[model samples]
Target: MTDEGELIAGRYRLLSRIGRGGMGVVWHARDERLDREVAVKELLLDTGDSAQAAEQAMRRATREGRVAARLRHPHAIMVHDVVEHAGKPCLIMEFLPSKSLATVLAERGPLPAGEVARIGEQVASALAAAHAEGIVHRDVKPGNVLLADDGTAKIADFGISRAVGEATVTGAGLIAGTPAYLSPEVAAGGEASPASDVFSLGATLYAAVEGAPPFGDDENPIALLRRVASGELVAPRRAGPLTDVLLRLLAGEAGERPTMVRAREALTAVSEGRPVELPPPRRPTLLSPAPRVRRRTVVVGIGTAALLIAGVLIGVLISSPGEPSAEGDQPPVIGSTSERPDSGCVARYAVTNSWPGGYQGEVIVRNDGEERLTGWVVRWKLPAGHTVDEVWNGSLSRAGSTVTVRSADWNSVVRVGDSVSFGFLGAVEAGEGAVPELVCLPD
Candidate 1:
């Protein structure tokens, strides 16, 4: 454990221990350079490791640092730096002054559907971004998610994430992720993928609504892994349609599970109080008989260019002419606008961090526009192929292809600079894609 006044990397002044995990201790610190609060994770080295293990550990740390640095998303915890502390690896990350989902649920009970959906969307978005970059977050569980003071959900701890095509540095005997959220493939030592992350998201969502993990008990890790491998976990009906989505995600066969995009759509429907229909199963082509190829017949013909010109002239006369243009000309109007006083108000939104599982983020709606806004609505377009899974902080309604979030009575009023924040969960399409569009409205 680090002393209260101890400083790491000569830049971060440790304030106090915020958390402790199997790998190390997490301290809340002040970044003297950025003048912002940050979290520093310090790992303590075990004395018995041989030279080979030490080299492997260093390699793993280097790989993790690279992966974490490459991942950039609103839901992902930003890594500021990685350095050696006490001869072991330590990572500096964005400091979140809020509690984890597990602690919040323990104290506040089950969260509402809207909150769950919003959190799920943000985490899924983050995962999509990481997966697009070929990084698989090996660990996705409730404890990894932090609900920030600004009501944003940020995923933390990339210590075990593996970049695609990279050599596996963690030993074979050790399990990398929490047993309760592990996919069957992961339990069997198979490579993790975006699909695996979706499975973990399902488990995390199940726990969020049910107030406990699907397969958790007082039993040991081995027993939990056995249950997960056997596919004997129960769905959390209390989570509503979220349970159905989880069932699909937790399917023993990865091919049978819905893609993150599809899952997000289902959850979005649930959040909007609409019925969700599962997509048709993709048929296996190999199981069907192959079609016979057919030979094409060739035709020999001759045409006269002079005759074609006459036919074209006759066709043009038979077609209707274009519509007439309008007669009047209108003048453009310009007006001076003043910013609302409530523009400075901060809107708060929350994302529940469940690493490797889901992506979530929150948007704060401030009355920056020149208006006393009430009963406001916000609309935004996700990336073309991306989809929203859940939403919270108000009534979320979707029209056509756009998502519209409206403030409820308790959250509706925003006077001159007053702000209100809302959150959403989405499954970002994994690949090299542009960031989704964001827009807001008042009144």
Candidate 2:
């Protein structure tokens, strides 16, 4: 309600209203005492809420500003002070002549991969720095990203951010971030982690390259929230080179999302004109095609009538599971025993479920090699006491005591130091046996 030229806290004079968002309005203002330009953000308070709740909300906002002040990154906006104006808290921050990423996208549509990556590198680095100090910018979206004239991309608006242990300002069941950018976990009422921020950044960059959020732009907030909570991401067609990294950051599993540090490195690689080596898409099935399949079979063409039947039957049996081969589906072939020392892939299996009659298992295969891996087949004995009943993510076959699980089309390639996970459900004789050892074969 304050008019232009009005002074707040007896120091800063309001010049004009520059921006308004759901939570607050930003003003082009002047620091009368320091004789400098500044931006003042007026925090909106709920008059209907009890006086106690309102007071708590004001303190929380001031505390968030103080936390943001601790950060001094080139890509992070600087928070100067917190003061009272119109009987409410107004946070004073640095004023920059720039446009929000949202406005830019509205005017220019999607950005180029290189430009998006450059912007992402700066913003991701800023996030990593803030995370290092135990702060989270709960709200990270195009609207909060500022593109300065000097080409600096800065992350603004920590109004809803809370220190790791602090309570949320949105109260129970209320999310603090834009629904379009919220991670699935947060949409499902899960706590926000560094990974959460990475998810948001992924969504933000996704919008940068695709011209809209991964989830469709539905006018209904609840519908959009449902889409985010569903964790079904629309792939980026125009992202081009940025497609891989953006998907990695938007992985459905929080643990699967790339770390901000790793994200920053990948983005930097793109910005520097180097190739970005990202791990597989968050959901492997969506992007990767199934590995090329090979099935070797034979049939007897001619022989004595009875002999022909026996020979043809042999072929069928030989090609079937539980038959032994000279080197039946062996581990990746090693040229020499000495070459084994150079193998860097590792596989681990865990029994996630079990019953007296059967159990379920999951295996993760990882590449620790210095170079990227192409395709792999993992071998493990089904254990003398167990029999595989069903499998997912792979083609499974048994030859005598050994079981081979070939990578599905999608998981054939493994990123350096990253991994692929697959699983199976199988029967157990006495429900007791030591797990089997796993060996990965290169394609």
Candidate 3:
């Protein structure tokens, strides 16, 4: 019921309501003392919670607000203060005159690939900064992205959504983001992390370039959630050069998704039309288990197909054989593998991700023997000018074009029906064979 001209805390006067979101109402206000314009967000807490829970939520919201104020970035809205007014937490932020990305997309339809990539790069840079400070913008979507009059894109509502999430309960549950842009893990009722923010950003950019969400936007929140939870996404036809980067951001497993820093790098590369070169994985374990698939029982018990659809949607489709992905769509596994047999063992090699002069690949070694294997070696010959620069989860040696990978002591034993994997980063001359036949031998 706060109207124009109402003074909150005796220092800031509300001029007009500028925007509204899932967490609260935002107002265009004037700082009476500072003599400047500011945006004030009044967060709405769920009254259904116990008095104690609500108070705890208030405290956490205040703390998060303070932390948000400490973050400074060009593409992020700055938090000026967190004040208690009328028993609600209100965040004072920098006011920039502009329309939301959502409004622009609604009016203009899908934008050009280059335009979207540039915008994504700015927003991703801001999110990267926030993440470095340990802040996860749980709600990232086109609506939260402001297209300023000066053509700068700044992300709003950093810590506020998380604060409201402490106590706000929607009819659909306590989800924090718009159903269409949520990561599969968040839609599946897990905690939001930096990776979730990356997925959400990917969905946002996907909508910007494709004119629709990866998962079609269903009217029923339940149905959308179900689609999101299923993590099935329609392929992007118009993403053009942005296809690979978007796919990386939308990876179903959080760990599989790149960090915000890397996301920024990828977006930057796309904006400039160059292949992105990623650093070697800090610690590459056995290819992370295929993305999490919510059990059918869990899905059915949650609600009707209509209700479950309210969840989030995401997927890069990293599935194993016979496992149907979200929405009953069966997308192929990412890379093709070549297998070669040698001396009681087998090695399968697949190039996971590649760039202009370099590529990443993995080799899975299986004993295929009745007895367990104490150790194994995988060998492959790189096409003339190609070379492996780094290897993980195994030891590496090379003689001329022949590359030999021996298992690390910790992962040396391969039990019956079990397999061990090693990954590498290699540089390849243009036009050389991408996937090489791998040979395995018992050590």
Ranking by lDDT: 3, 2, 1
- Candidate 2 shows a clash count of 3
Q: Can you write out model 2's per-residue Cα lDDT over 112-220, one digit (the tens) per residue?
A: 9999999999999999999999888877889899998788999997635332112222332222334678776565433467888999999999888888777756654
The RMSD (Cα, Å) of candidate 2 is 18.8
User: What's the distance in Å from true for residue 290, model 1?
Assistant: 47
Return whichever of 1 and 2 wins on TM-score. 2
lDDT of 2: 0.68
Top lDDT model: 3
Model 3 residue 440 CA deviation in Å: 34
- Each model's TM-score? 0.58, 0.62, 0.62
Error of 1 at 11 (Å): 1.5
Cα-based lDDT for every prediction: 0.58, 0.68, 0.71
Better of 1 and 3 by TM-score: 3
Model 1, runs deviating above 4 Å:
44-52, 159-177, 218-220, 280-443
Q: Which ten residues in a row have the lowest lDDT in candidate 1?
A: 310-319
